[model samples]
Target chain A: MRVQFVLQEIWIGLRRNLTMSISLVITVAIAMALFGTGLLINKQVSNSTNYWYDKIEVSIFMCTKTSSNTSCNKADATQEQKNTIKSDLEKLPQVSAVEYESKDAAFARFKDQFSSTPGMVQSTKAGDIPDSFRVRLKNPEEYKSVSSAMLGRPGVDQVVNEQEILKKFFRILNGLQWAALLIAGIQVIAAVLIVGNTIRLSAFNRRRETGIMRLVGSSNMYIQLPFILEGAIAGLVGGILAAFLLVLSKIFLIDRLQGSLQFASQLSWSSVVGIIIFSVCVGVLLCALASFLTLRRYLKI
Target chain B: MIHFDNVTKVYPSQNRPALQHVNVAVEKGEFVFLVGPSGSGKSTFLRLVLKEERPSQGHVHVAGKDLSRLNNWKVPHLRRRIGCVFQDFRLLPNKNVFENVAFALEVIGKPRRFIGKVVPEVIDLVGLEGKAHRMPDELSGGEQQRVAIARAFVNRPMILLADEPTGNIDPATSIGIMKVLDRINRTGTTVVMATHDAAIVDAFRKRVVELEDGRVVRDQSRGVYGQAY
Candidate 1:
């Protein structure tokens, strides 16, 4: 019976302040959407990092006969020098696998990659391709160690790690993630304040009813339950809307963007689901907190 | 039952006490009238009994619980035994008459079945049976006061405190309200009314306690108003 009364009170209270309820819902929805976007971007960064880093390799470009640099004066490496370099690389504890790519083999691989791009294919000459050792390590962090060891070695002109080129990419992504997160934080604070003030106004309007409730021996929880539920219900509706927006963004925007940037096609569906769940939880919890704080003074039930 | 043992209440930012050192007692099922001019501590005395304001210098005992020792959590339990009606009517403007009365029983956790039966009975007792569906704003001042009365009595509390309940109504309506209160008092509910209405005081001639400058100037059975001065 008490539960029924409380539900009735909540229903009536919501109906009484319909405009405030809608405002609360919109505030929560926008905040959750911003926060959800930040989460999705953060997830995307992690996924891309893991995907690219796992395939990252240190490439040791062998000296060529026509190379002008003093480091390549000896010209092409002999079979004995190649065997010695390969054996030395295997001796390192961090060395997981070392594969040799001859100059002809490197040219063939390049041609296959740019086969569809005639402009890129015609731009590269056969002799321009460098014979290299594609070195894979047990951990991506060991790239620096392997690259340093391979540099200035006999018949080696330049040693490059693909991970270095992608470092700047990750840094930019990380900065964007932080920027989105900052915006989310600001929106969340504004949403909380809006929810608090709305509930406060509702409390003020019903001050007489609350006073009577207090006078009639109603417990504090009994009086606060309806208001808190009001905020939470608004928040829940907002969160679901935000989640729908996020899912739509993933399906439409992110999918289209990834289609153009094919390397990121592997972004996980699980991450999107995780973001939606997190956003909903934040929406409900923060609104409940704001409502509780607002009611602290008014009800005193 | 209520007892005030030399209770004194000093309001904040005031040079003098609102309720000077005074004492009084009223047994269960008794109807007492507290009469005084404005700022004579009549409201303060009622507030003291309600525990809304604490007596600064003495003890106030109601229903055997010392008001001074009652903590915040226990205040609600104490209030459950007492019903309060105000001059403002204090009905939720949006609620209909039935909801106003039902709210009293609702706050006390009365079952829906009990509330449905008791609310109508109380509304009938207050002669507001036809006005149950009307909002407070739509009702006349007399009807609104009757709704307030019904809300006060719906819980069947041991004590009912009315602070100028008829202050907003005309003489005829005031008499009607008094008759309803008299009917409730007949049912063994102790009644403490704080009012300055001389005519009502003289007509009922109950135990009247009059205050002057925070001091009790008169206490008499079958008394008339304005006798203290």
Candidate 2:
């Protein structure tokens, strides 16, 4: 019976403070949306680092007539020179596998990789792309060992480790994730302040009722329940709205990016599901904490 | 039912104590009038019995429980045995008369079945039988006080504390409110009222405990409201 009464009281309170409740719902939704975006960015950064680092290779470019390196001043690498270089790379314990790419094959792979960037793909000629030996490492962290060994070798123009390029990309991703997190933090604090103010206002407006209730022997918990429930309802509504916006953004934007940029790793289904659940829980938990703390401070009864 | 042993209450922000070494006791089922001029510690006396304010140097015992020794969590149980009414009536503006009365029992976790039976019975006893559906704003001051009285009595408290229950109403309404208190007292509920209404105090002819500057100046059985010094 008391539960029923409390529910009725909560409903009445929400209705009476409809505008405040609506603003609270919107604030929580926006805050949680930013939080969800931060989570996604963090996951993307980790996923890309793991996905790319495992497949990253060190490329030893063979000398050609267009090459400027003094080390590659000689004629194009012969079959014997190529085979000997490949054998030497394989002899190194850190070298997992070595594959030779001719100029034709390099051009073909470049075209395939940049197919979506039609302007850049069309600008490249058959001979413009370099012929090189792609060396996979047992541990990507050992890229330094392979690059130093291949550098200055006869008939080699350049030794480029894919991990170096990936490192730069990951640095930018990490910075972006941190920036997103900072934004989310500010927004969550804003949402909490609004919620606290709304609770305080509601408590002030109902002081007469609470004063009477206290005089008639009502417990503190009984007086606080309705206000707490008011906050929770706003949070629950905001959580639902945030989840919807998150999923909509994923479907309309992220999914399209995933389709066109197939080489980049996408977020896993289970992790996305976890994010949705986390968004809802965080919203409710934050509002509950805010409400409880504010009420304890301001509600005399 | 109520005892104050050398109770002295010095409000922290005030230079003078609200109650100073005051001593008073009321037996069960007695009607007592706590009469005093403004700021003579009548409100403080009632507040002490309610445990709303603790005595700075002494102890208060109400309904067989020592309030000074009572845990804050256990204060509610002590309060449940005491009913309080005020000059303002303190009725919830949104709720009607019946709901205002039923709210007292509802808060204490009383069974709905019990509330359903006791609320109407008490409302009838307060003689607002047909005004149960009227909101507090829709009723006269006397009727509103009756609703407050009904709420206090619906819990069947052992002691009823009224801090100037008739202060806001006219004399005609004041008499009606007093008669309701009289009726409730006749049913064996101890009554303690704080007021400045000399005529009502003199007319009731009950035990009057008058305070002067936070000290009890008079304690007379069937006393009259005294003249100003």
Candidate 3:
């Protein structure tokens, strides 16, 4: 009720529990940093996946002279078979566009793809290349249906999508993001519990003082206000420290990664800023709630 | 100002009731001594008036309001009208005597200017005028008790409850504490004090209420501390 006295008591309580307060700050800071990082990385991963999905093409390889699959054993795909396949693909509602790649075009693409390695180009010949149909689907997720439909068709060697190749890479990014988030979850819980324990200890230590106040007609909120403020201040400090760490990582780690990864899309500042604000709010609010509940349970007025 | 109608108290951990069939009343501006031995419900009597403990049966009333019917949130308001002191002289080790006394008015949302004016008056009333800046640890046991009394009386309550106010102090300092309590009583505030100090009880020669096994065995005006042990 007395604002000045309550503020003074908060300062005193924080000072007296200096060690515990410091530890609580550090714990909340570390947890918030990890939480922000996890959020940012998740955004990055999702952005990367969506970008790659648009570029994904369902490649339908045609039979060639060296092809060994039963579907391709008879001979190179005849002109009628190739025409039939093209018409079939166009008829499917899921197919957006289709491009035909002849053997000569495949050989040219192979050479250009291996231009950096002269030996790779030297080892390949025109007849060694396979003709294919590059099919773009209206929805990338429908690639599964296209792949299955073309699997055993006449003169078809294989049906493959680019997403399958990038699966290994996306798996790693998602795994890292999940691991970071899981650890952050655990750390946040620990931070809340640490705040709770610190409040309980301070309450126990100051029982004598509070008992006197209770007798002197102080309300429960009046007695608990100082401790709640202490927890909130510590949480705010932790949030600030975490925001600092997140900005540092963005400059030193993420920006540099984007420099070499020009093909990949980067997350916007709003997302990082959003995460910073969210973590800070969560830190302060959660700690205050924990401290308040702890006082209600243990620091009876 | 205070009344107990056949009040009985039973703690969950103890089989027997602390106070049984207790009926007592004290008028406004009266100084009453509650004399009893160990485990004879002195503390319980004070606690009931403060609403710290609810009676298991019967009713306790203070300021014409039945405590059993009082809302939990209204307890603080009720206590604001009553002052309480204890034997341990529970003082905040971090605060000085002045701050401790001012704490009472501060919690009840008094303005700063008013607290500034009233803190010194109560400190002087408790006879600790110059020692206002002394921390609890800096004061003697008696002076600490004086600070507790100053804190309790700073709000100028209608009633004052002292549970063993002199239990932890020596006979000489205990007299000083008694004199301060008596002085506060003379200022038109009803005073209810529980004590085992037979000397102070007999010397003060006020209304004496003796309890034995949770029942009032003797109550008389201008009475001495009768040898009932």
Best candidate (score: lDDT): 3
> What does DockQ give for each predicted structure?
0.70, 0.70, 0.57
Model with the higher lDDT, candidate 1 or 3: 3
lDDT tens per residue, model 2, B102-173: 888887778899999999999999998888899999999889989999998898889999999999999988
Least well predicted 10-residue stretch by lDDT in candidate 2 chain B: B72-81
Lowest summed lDDT over 10 consecutive residues: which window, candidate 1 chain A?
Answer: A257-266
**What value does the interface RMSD of model 2 take?**
1.1
A157-187 in candidate 2: lDDT tens per residue?
Answer: 8999887887786786677667767887888
Name model 2 segments beyond 4 Å from true: A68-70, A73-80, A252-264, B227-229
DockQ of 2: 0.70
- Binned by DockQ into CAPRI classes (incorrect, acceptable, medium, high), candidate 3 is medium
Give the per-residue lDDT of model 3 (tens digit) for B12-87: 8999899999999999999999987899998899989999899999999999999999999889889999998888
In model 2, what lDDT does residue A293 have? 97
lDDT of 1: 0.86
Per-residue alpha-carbon lDDT of candidate 3 for residues A1-301, written as tens digits (9 for 90 to 100): 4888789778877877889999999999999998888888788878888898887899999998888887687589888989999999999999999999999999998897677789989988897888999999899889988888888888888888887877877787678788888999999999999999989888877777677677777887888888998899999999999999999877776677666544378778888899899999998998899999898899866
On TM-score, the candidate that comes out on top is 2
- The lDDT values for all models are 0.86, 0.87, 0.88
Worst 10 residues of 2 chain A by lDDT: A254-263
* TM-score for each of the candidates: 0.88, 0.95, 0.86
Q: RMSD in angstroms, all models? A: 3.4, 2.0, 3.9
Q: What residue runs in model 1 are displaced by over 4 Å at the alpha carbon?
A: A40-55, A63-94, A102-129, A138-145, A249-268
